[model samples]
Structure formats: structure tokens, C-alpha cells
Target: MDIQHGSGGTYRTLVDESPLSGLQWAVFVLCFLIMFLDGLDTVLIGFLAPYIGAEWKLAKGALTPVFTAGVVGLMIAGCMAGILADRVGRRPLLLAAVAVFGVANLATAYCASLEALVVLRFVTGLGLGAAMPCAVTLVSEYAPARRRAFVITSMYCGYTLGGAAVGWLTPIVAQQHGWRAMFVVGAVLPLALLPWLFWRLPESIGFLAERRRDRGAVAALLSRIVGRQVELPALPEQQKVEGNPLAIILSPAFRMRTGLLWLANGAGLLMTFTLINWLPSFLTFKHVPAQTASLSGASLQAGGAIGALLIGWLMDRFGSRKVVVGTYLGAAVASLLWIAVLDRSSAALLLMGFVAGVLVMGGQTGFQVLATSVYPVAARATGLSWMQSVGRLGGILGIQLAGMGIASDVDPISLLQALAIPALVAAVAAAFLHVTPRHVPGNAAVLKGG
Candidate 1:
């Protein structure tokens, strides 16, 4: 592709056609790793649930709040950070989020009671919540338009793989050392990556173009992405420095699209997180052994990691509308299969669980990619953040619903039936993925490349 000289249009055109540079790859990997750490930190507790219950001699409902606590923190922080990142910047908030979660998780290793566990989980949630929307915004802005879905979805696989790691290693670690050792591993790893994030992570080019007062910083990054010395244009839009950044996403022009996107995502999260946080315990409740239960849960995540890669490719090839709708419907079908034989066989449990993971996680992955494409750069972070914030509410509710099911002695098959409703709603509403952002000055230029 030939480089042109002029305003930021040249920069946008250059990136749209240009091959991804080494620097862009490094940024993707860094985002992937941060999310990987988040996955490990977030899901490790689910794998440890049986052990924790055994050690504390607590009732099933006792751990329900523990499960929802971090997610609630995550819910709050995701909304706050998304809005804040629009005004402040993505890089600093991301770094702070990683450091906060890493240290908080390290502290989680020392919690002795339910109260202490809940408090620390909430703090860690704040960091975990903050990292994701910022990461999504960074990756979406940096990726070229043609390959955007595939690249961002591939990066999200790191998160699913992280959750899978907890499942694969939990039995061994707990058997040899203890469940606390798993938290130690999670704590040490993200903290270790802080320096690399500092050195390698680049702020979103679009963000710099949109927000930075410093021309040299934008020029330096463009040089790296463009693979040579490059003259850059002025910031694409002069900073208005105006009203609440998040309110822009909620403005009337975006009201319908935003609401529907939240509905799809919230429903998706309710389905996926319900399975992830409760699958192991659910299986155990049916008399499956703890070790096997952990493996079954891991299989679900493994399927999700694999499914995300496949769904992303299909989305890039076929478009987000079909792929996103199909994924949720697939989850619905898999849930139907589970309802028939769920309580009876161990073989059925793992196989059906894996299928559910693939479709449900893949669908959720599509929602994230679609969100990155939905909003203008001005409120992109807030848009993604709020979408995820609503999703986290679903996750928290999923955990609570599972607890309630357990308390009421609701059978596994019945709960599976209830889970299928959201998948159907998401499938039906996938049409909303094509909704346009509010019309604004320069949106055509900014959205054209995306």
C-alpha cells in the first residue's frame, strides 16, 4: 500500500491497508497476557469451591456471595474505568488495573474467613474489571479494519485459556500443595508482567490521535505501526473536553442500539458465567467426584478457547450478524441436549458441558467483538465498558441464581432449562449488532476504517 501525505485520513488509510507491524503484534500479546492473568485470577475460585467448602465446613449458600463479590466490584469498576479512560487515557488506567488486581489477588491468598474473602475479591474485581474494556478498546483501535474481528477475538482466547489453566492444574496443585498455592501462582504471574507491560504496551493510536496533546508521542507510535519515519497529521478532532463521556453512549441516537446490545451481552454473560462458576459444583452435587468435576469444568473452557478462535474466523468471513446469532442458538441447542440426560451420566456431563462452553463462550466472544465495532472512538471505551458492566451483572445474578437453585433443591435439568432462555433471546436480538453509532462530526472518517 502506498502512503499518502495530508491529515489523519492518510494515517487511517495507511493502517487500513498496511500489514500489522511487529509493534502491533507486541501490543496484542501484551493485552492477551493481561487478560490471561485475569482469567486465572477470576475463575480459580470456582475450581477451589469444593475444597473451600470442605475446609470451612460451610453451607453451599455461604460461598454464593463469595462468588458474586468480585464480579460486583468488577461491575462497578468496568463502568467507572470505561468512562474515565475516555477522559484520561487507556494506558495509565490499564497499568493501574493490572497492578491493583495482582496485589489484591496476592492478598486473597491470606484470607481466613468469608468476610475477608469477600472484601479481597471485590478489590481484585475492580482491577479485573478495569483491564478488559481498556484492552478491548486498545486492540480494536489498533487492529486494521479487515482483520479486526479475528485479531480481537484471538486475543480474548487468552482469557478463556487462563480459566482453563485453573481447571487443568487445580487437582494437582491442591493435591500436592494446597488450594492457596493456586492463588499464589495467580498473584505472582501478573505482577511479574508489570514491567513488560510498562515497556511494551502502546496506547491506542486512535486514542493518541483523538486525545493526546503531545504530537511527538503520536508520531513515535505511528512510526512504529507504519514501519518507518512518518509525518503525522494534527489530532483528528480537537478535544471538546465537555460533558460526561459515558452519557454520549447513552444519548438518544444510541439508545435503542445500546439497550439491545446490553440485553444480548447481559443474557450471554448470564448463560456463560452460570456454567463456568457453577458447573463443577453442579456436577459434584450430582455425585460426580471432585477431581472429575474440575476436569469437566476445564473441558468447558478448553472448548471455549477453541470455539472463540473458530467463531472469530467465521465472523470475519461471514460477518458478525450471522456468526453471533448462530453461536447463541448453538448454545441453546446444546442446553436442550443436556436437559435430556444431564442428571444421569458422567459421560453426558463432560460432553454436553464442553459443547455448551464452545457455543456460549463463542457467542459471548462475538458480542465483545461486535461492541468494539459499535461505538465511535469518542465513547468507544465507555460503550464497551457499559456493555461488559451489564454483562457482569448477569454473571453476578447467575451465581446468585445458582445458589438459590441449590437452596431450593432445584434439579440440574430444570436449571439447564432456565439457562436456555437467555441464549434464545441473544440469538433473536443479534440483529442489533448492525446498529450504527450516533451521528457526529468526523464519525464517517473514524468509522470508515473500522
Candidate 2:
């Protein structure tokens, strides 16, 4: 079958009609590795905090600024890199981003002072922030609509896996070589993957079509995806979105969905990061052993990894909005149950923690999928980066709020229970996303049945 190039939607239709290709699978795997590196580097600092503090002869909490620096960098890149990707291309931006973080992580391993570490971490965050949105956008553009949400979510499962890998690697690496070794490993893996990404990673088809450049290249790429020759008609040129991409997403036509996505994604990240940062300490405060507390925290990550894939499959078969809504609501209930059973049983706490993660973490990743389905190709990277930036802000706010509560000597249980509120907020916001099958005039195909 030949892919007939016409309106923007025709490309989506062509890919949807074709079976998955080897090159498409390669794209998925490469994006997944990028995500994995993103997660490993993002969480590596946290794992190294204790070892770094001990080696530097620093007091407790001296590393807070380092954490803040990284997050601030992530937010900045999330905004800037995404807009640049839309204008330039996803492959170049992604390659540059991975190189930045890889070098930053290597530099982090040899830094002499806390201030230097903070700066390097910030740079690392910049690479990470830019890399993730571009990776997801690339995957979303390539995958068939039938499997769009699933592929994106499953690819993102690499992020959680990367985090989990750090949890295991930190203890072994730190115990033997040093905490710096963690950064070294983080650096080397992504640096090694960079060559592979450059060789294998394909540019977004939508990006090339939209720009009306490299028409031959677009045909070649589409031809490979379909395992047959793709015929080209000059794609009908569309009106250009002028000025900033952020403005386009916020324009009257897209304002409502944008607002709802911000709320849902922000609230989801708020709950996710809060629970991740505080659960172990909170469990310890309740007299759970340190080891057990760590295990409970891990259960959340494990649950999240499982939940993302399951939720994505469900979203594909059913619909994205309803599945996301249900997942967040379930997370709300799971969070409550997790904290409620804390005093009585270890097994129950672990079970509940896992369940809460399945919903909370799962639902958080689901927002990325939802964002992909909401915006058309022209402003997709901007929309995704903005949504993620808001989510990152929510994470910072949640961590800070939790810290304030602990500092003020609030009951740990009360603070833990309050985490459930964000889940409820996310659920309500997702419920209002209203992403039906109705088409906007100029927007390209979103999900066919989202």
C-alpha cells in the first residue's frame, strides 16, 4: 500500500493504516533509552546527597540548593527547548540535550565544591528537561493512533525504571567506589547512547511535513515505516502559527483544554513527587524500620511502572479522558488507604503504597499521553513542555510544602493524608478535559477516538 501525501491528517492516516515497522520500533527503543537516562540523572542527585554530604563534611540540608538548582534548570529547559524543537527539529534538539546532560553528569562527578555541584546539576536538569519532552513528542508523532497512547506511556515507563535502577546502583556504587561513581555511570550510559540515537533516531514526520522542507526525505521515511514506497503529492501548505508557540496554545481556540491539562498534570505531579519525597521519612516517623520504609517507597515506583503500561493499554481500548479520570480517582482512594493502614500492618502498607503508585504515578504519565492527543503537531512540543513545566512547578511546590509541614512539627499522618487532596484535584481536572472526537478546523488529526 502506498502512503498518499495530502493534508496533514493523511500522514497520520497512513501510519495508522500500516503495521508497525522495524524503524518505528527502533525509534521507540531509542526514546525509551533517552527517558531512562533522563530518570537516572534526575534521581541520581538525590541518591548521592547523603554520600556527598558526608564527604564534604556538611551539615544536614546543605544540599537543598543543589536540588533547587536542578529543578529550576529543568523548568527553564522545558519551556525553551520545546519551542526550539518545534521550530528547528526534534532530532537535533534531542541530540544536543542528551549531550548537555551527559557532559554535565560527568562534570558533576569531579566537582570540588557544593556550589559547583549545584551548577552542574542545573545543567544536567536542562538537558533532562529538554530531552524528555522531545522524546515523547517524537514517539507520539511516529506511533500509530491505535497504539499512540500505549507506546508513549510504555516508553515513559523507562523513566521509572531508570529511577529504580539508581536505587539499586547507588548502594553498590557508593559502597565501593564512591557516590561520584553514580554520576560517572549516569554520564557514560547516556553518552554511549548518544551515538546510537544520532545514527538511528528519525525526525518527526509531522515536523518535516509542516515545514514543507525535505519532501523527498519525508517520503523515504514514510516508505520505510510502511515497508513499501510512499507516493507524494505536495502537502497542502497550512497557515503558519505566528509569534511564540506558547501563545498559540493559549489562544482562544485551545485555551480551555490547555487550562484543564495544566490543572490535571500539575496536580498529578504534586501528588507524585510529594509521595516519592516524603513517604519513606513519613513511614519512619510512624516507627517503620528504615529498611522497610525504603521498601515501601520502592513499591510505589514498581507500581507506577506497572500502572503506566496497564493504563495505556486501557486508554487505547477505551478512551484517554475516562481512563485518566478513573486512574486519578483510584489514586485518591489508594493514597487514603495507604496511610490509614500504616499503623496496623507492614504488608498492608506496602500493598497500599503500591496501589497508590499504580494510580498516582501511572496517572501522572497518563497526562503526557493526554497532552499528545490534545494538541495538533504545530504546537505540540510547546503544549507538552508547558504542561510539564507546570507539573515540575507542582513537584517543587509539593516538596516544599511537605518540608514546611515537617518543619512546623505537624503530625506526619495528617501531612501524609493531605497528599490525597492532590489526587482528587487531578481526577476532577481530568474529568473536565473534554477531549472528544470533534475536530477543530486547522488542527491536524489528534487521536481518532480520544
**In terms of lDDT, which candidate is strongest?**
1
Clashes of 1: 0
Q: Backbone clash tally for model 2?
A: 0
Decoy 2 TM-score against native: 0.91
What does candidate 1 score in Cα RMSD to the true structure? 3.1
* Runs in model 1 lying further than 4 Å from the true structure: 1-10, 233-243, 340-348, 432-450
Q: Show the lowest summed lDDT stretch of 10 residues, model 1.
A: 441-450
Model 2: worst 10 consecutive residues (lDDT sum): 441-450
User: 1-450, model 1: which lDDT tens digit per residue?
Assistant: 112222345555666677899988998999999888888888888888888898899987678888899889889999999988887889999999999999998898888999999999899999999999999889888888788888888988888899999999999998788878888898999999999999889877776666544667777777888788877544334333445667877887777777888988998998877888888988788788888789888888878888889988888887787888888887887877766655566776677767877898867888788777767776889999999998788888888998899988998667776887889988877765455554544332222322
Task: Write model 2 residue lDDT over 56-85, tens digit each, in one string.
Answer: 897544666676677778889999988999
RMSD of each: 3.1, 2.9
- In model 2, residue pairs whose N, Cα or C atoms come closer than 3 Å (at least 3 residues apart or on different chains), thus clashing, are none
Return the TM-score for candidate 1, rounded to 2 decimals: 0.93
Local accuracy by lDDT, each model: 0.81, 0.79
